[model samples]
Target chain A: MGAAKVSADHPGIDELFALLAYGEVAAFYRLTEEARMAPDLNGRINMALMAAAEMGHFELVSDALEQRGMHVQQAMAKYRSVLESYHAQTIPSTWEEALVKTYIGDALAADFYLEIAEGLPDEIADVVRGVLAETGHSQFVVEEIRAAVAASDQQRSRLALWARRLLGEAITQAQYVMAERDELVDLVLSGTNGLGQLTEFFEKVQRTHADRMAELGLA
Target chain B: MGAAKVSADHPGIDELFALLAYGEVAAFYRLTEEARMAPDLNGRINMALMAAAEMGHFELVSDALEQRGMHVQQAMAKYRSVLESYHAQTIPSTWEEALVKTYIGDALAADFYLEIAEGLPDEIADVVRGVLAETGHSQFVVEEIRAAVAASDQQRSRLALWARRLLGEAITQAQYVMAERDELVDLVLSGTNGLGQLTEFFEKVQRTHADRMAELGLA
Candidate 1:
């Protein structure tokens, strides 16, 4: 299949960039707040470190938007409602829940960003790729989850269930976003196998999630 | 006066490293937490980005300590009392206060770390220098403080007083650490001209602080 051409006025590109920036900003706030829920100083510091990484990604995207003569705040405001609703509907209630959120949520974002990065112009793609490269939070989540599961069977079971719920909420919110932003949906569906590629993308991600769970003795 | 040579077995080095690591961790925590207090999403995201940079520094130090067969947690525990006391005594109570803390606190740290980085062996020094190179947070602090001061004369006075208090507490804590850790004091004094030079070093820093205050219209 031929690569789909995106115009400069492509609403999908605009919506995607705006949503990505807003997501970064919200991740910064939410992760910093979540860091307080850590059981110990070490855990707290680790969460704080992860939260900070989100900010670096935010700067990259915001700078890109500025380069286009777009006001970041205005662009961010455009997608605030959908993003806020997603987060509000999927609040993590415990340490395990938080870890799952960080782990799965970041993986989904990384996958999508990587795919989108491929279709953008060089400068924009570089920014997106650089932002995606800073995935220390995911590494932390995997380690933390493994350690928690190793500590007890009960903890393992609880976290496994929590991870599933997190996945559900994430998918629900994501579908809402895709439905609302046709341009974004088009951009995502552009270079892929076809319009149905999203389903395949979801399957691949779920397989990765399952592998991670099995590694943690959750499966 | 001749520089005092520090003994290889000097417990003060341990104490100093402990104090330094603890301070880094706390700064990482506070900065990340305070990012939430940003009035606007942009400001909040910037603070969070700054907080994230500190985590990179935190990891560098933590890894360095680990490589030396030292447990980061134990080292942090050793200096918890002094570092926690310092922060508690000088907690910022407002946005202006927070900016002052970031400005004065980060600047002093950069200066001291830069000096120490120069004196250490290549591996250790390289990490410290690498961290010092990332001054986005410091720049943010300077900008925020300058904007706040430019906004109002009263705001400048309040921030000036807050900055002074922060320095006062910092010096008090430094003196306490100096008295308790002769090896570090000796290392610092020896690396430079002498005890006399150490006094001059701090004096130079104080003068710079005052200059910064005046430049901000706070003096």
Candidate 2:
């Protein structure tokens, strides 16, 4: 639709879509799996809804990959281990922890995507922008975490520790990803026209994450 | 949109929606949970997408219940144990088994809902019919099961046996429900103009099940 996607010529763009697509599908899996940890039926339903929203985004990006003449599965397979490892290493232990992971993990991904979206071609950028828009279920996670934190000092401190762990795990994985995927690293840096250096870009992301932690009153 | 649903005045209608809504949410949970057993990424994604479709139907019936002035949680709570027990008792041990349970469980529920859909008030019946329509994911299940069965006699025999077990377990719970919920029994019987006796009703359902088994080449 947007210039017929010269995607095959752009390994970086395909990597971008595949990264986004697999991230979404993996999120769908993690959220639904973690729904088991929910303290109540309402909590379980919220996680399931959140998972479904991620699948909705997966479908969008998946279509883009297919239209670009890439096999969705193969493209996604390139990063399955890494992405799944990210979720595996950070399996949320409590309902509050799961909420924190969902909130922080998703916010961090959005910030990273927006960071690189501008460097991609128009078609790829549009697809990225379209699916990155919030599905609004994140607000439920935020409110639930805020309420839980407000309940007790023990709870607040526990989640604060959990959030920092999530952030650390995410940064570790992001660093691993950039080191491994040359195209992705190139794609990310090219979008840094508003930025001066790669360090500044990551600094902005970290600042936003800090703001999110504060919003949850965890900071 | 359809007559604004005079749902509060009709406890039977609320029961119907509650049963359907809880049924959907449970299915959403089960399918996603079972997606863990999927043989490949494709299988997992298929199950996840199927689960998401169930959630979509859940939202429809859930919104319907909320509009009827019923608390969705309280109403759904009525059947939580019974439904959860159904899934807990029949945890599929293999990917093929997961596929079998998914295919059979969903089809059986659909047939039962359609069986009672006719005698309900037009509005409730319409909602039932609307959501009852297959989201088309079943074809994937059927195809997968058939392919697995075609490859080996062991798979064919195992799934056939497993399918009967699912049927028996489902019938036990369903009979228990009819005995417990007077409103549900009355609503079901009310729809029996085309149906002669309750036994005949179940006989028809069984015939359909047999037909489905034949379609799967399992019978």
User: Taking the tens digit of each residue's C-alpha lDDT, what string does model 2 give over A99-140?
Assistant: 899989998999888767755667777889877878788888
Indicate the worst ten consecutive residues by lDDT in candidate 2 chain A.
A1-10
Q: Model 2: residues >4 Å from true position, as ranges?
A: A1-9, A193-195, B1-9, B193-195
Model 1, residue A198: what's the lDDT?
A: 68
Which candidate gets the maximum TM-score versus the true structure?
Answer: 2
Screening candidate 2 with a backbone cut-off below 3 angstroms (N, C-alpha, C), the clashing residue pairs are none
How well does chain B match by TM-score in each candidate? Answer: 0.85, 0.92
Least well predicted 10-residue stretch by lDDT in candidate 1 chain A:
A1-10
Question: Positional deviation of B21 in candidate 2, in angstroms?
Answer: 1.3
Candidate 2's docking class is medium
lDDT of each residue in A30-133, candidate 1, tens digit only: 77677667888777777777776777777888887887778988888878887777678768888877877777677767766776666665666677787666
- Quote the lDDT for A36 in model 2: 82
Error of 2 at A168 (Å): 2.0
For model 1, report the TM-score of its A chain. 0.88
- Chain B TM-score for candidate 1: 0.85
**For all the predictions, what are the DockQ values?**
0.52, 0.78
Best by lDDT: 2
